[model samples]
Target: MRSGGLMGTAALALLAAPAWAQSASSGDGDSFLGGEWQPVDPAELEQMRGGFEMPSGLNVSFGIERAVYVNGDLVANTVLNIPDIAAITPEQAAQVADFNRGRVVQIGEGNVVMPAQMAGALVVQNTLDNQTITTLTRIDVAVDSVATLQAINFSNLISDALAGSVSP
Candidate 1:
């Protein structure tokens, strides 16, 4: 389980990419290796983007048990094996609750105890039938800043520090 601080940081890094990218300077903006500094080619960024792809599917299996003996006891869990889904239709996904079809969403918490790393894929990818269209430009320079701010708030995250403290 993350202490919550780390989860916030991870979220910040994921959300603040464009903000940092815009402010970052390349090699002092003068010269590097006896040549003008050039930002990485967009083509390369596109190619590198491929590494992020995953075979589409849903593999779901887990076990949990909450038992209270007469003497007062509770909690049990287990490991389950779900065959590879890799790719499944909405009908299949519906079998698992909250597994929404169309458009990948953000974040997953491991077990009930571990919290999800607070990260949003700023890069929204659309995967189609055997083809994935990763939109490079769709990363709107503008987005509501809530998620970004919440990320960098390392000490106390929004959930904990959501409301400002007032002093008289």
Candidate 2:
């Protein structure tokens, strides 16, 4: 009878464990890596004119959690994943890292930092010129003037900053 009771207690404990575990987890599964890597919709697909085309075999297990636009063009996209970051290549990892380091998008008067995992494949459009700048780059991260720099980071990155705050 003791053994049966112990088994019953164990079963009850197992059932209760998941409830607590779910609270700590991003149960929404909205991540930029390994989550869902689906392709851009037909309406959104028209924007990728001068960048690496989304691979045909690109697997997307989850929907995009966020979409970023610049100059009315789709610039950055993010999702979630369940697997390890190692699933992507080192070069890809580097690109992702580069994309994320200082990715700050200047929308209107505000500076928004893009998430790291979705950094590599950002597609930003210049609000002024309406140009679709493919790829977030280190150069792009640089603020234009001292005022913009002041708006984002007041570091001395202005004179030595890259062309943009994004990396491919």
The model with the greatest lDDT is 2
Per-model CA lDDT versus the true structure: 0.35, 0.39
Model 1 alpha-carbon miss at residue 125, Å: 41
lDDT of 2 by residue, 1-168 (tens): 576455445445545556654663445664344465554574443222112211332222211234555546865554322222436556545544554553444444333455555544443324454444444222101111323323323233342255346544
- The lowest-lDDT stretch of 10 consecutive residues in candidate 1 is 74-83
lDDT of 1 by residue, 41-156 (tens): 75444322211112222111322111222213222111111223455446434433322111232223332221243222122222323432322221211223434344445435
Q: TM-score for all predictions? A: 0.25, 0.22
Following a full C-alpha superposition, what root-mean-square deviation does model 1 have from the true structure? 19.8
Q: What is candidate 2's TM-score against the reference?
A: 0.22
Count of residue pairs whose backbone atoms collide, per candidate: 5, 23
Worst 10 residues of 2 by lDDT: 136-145
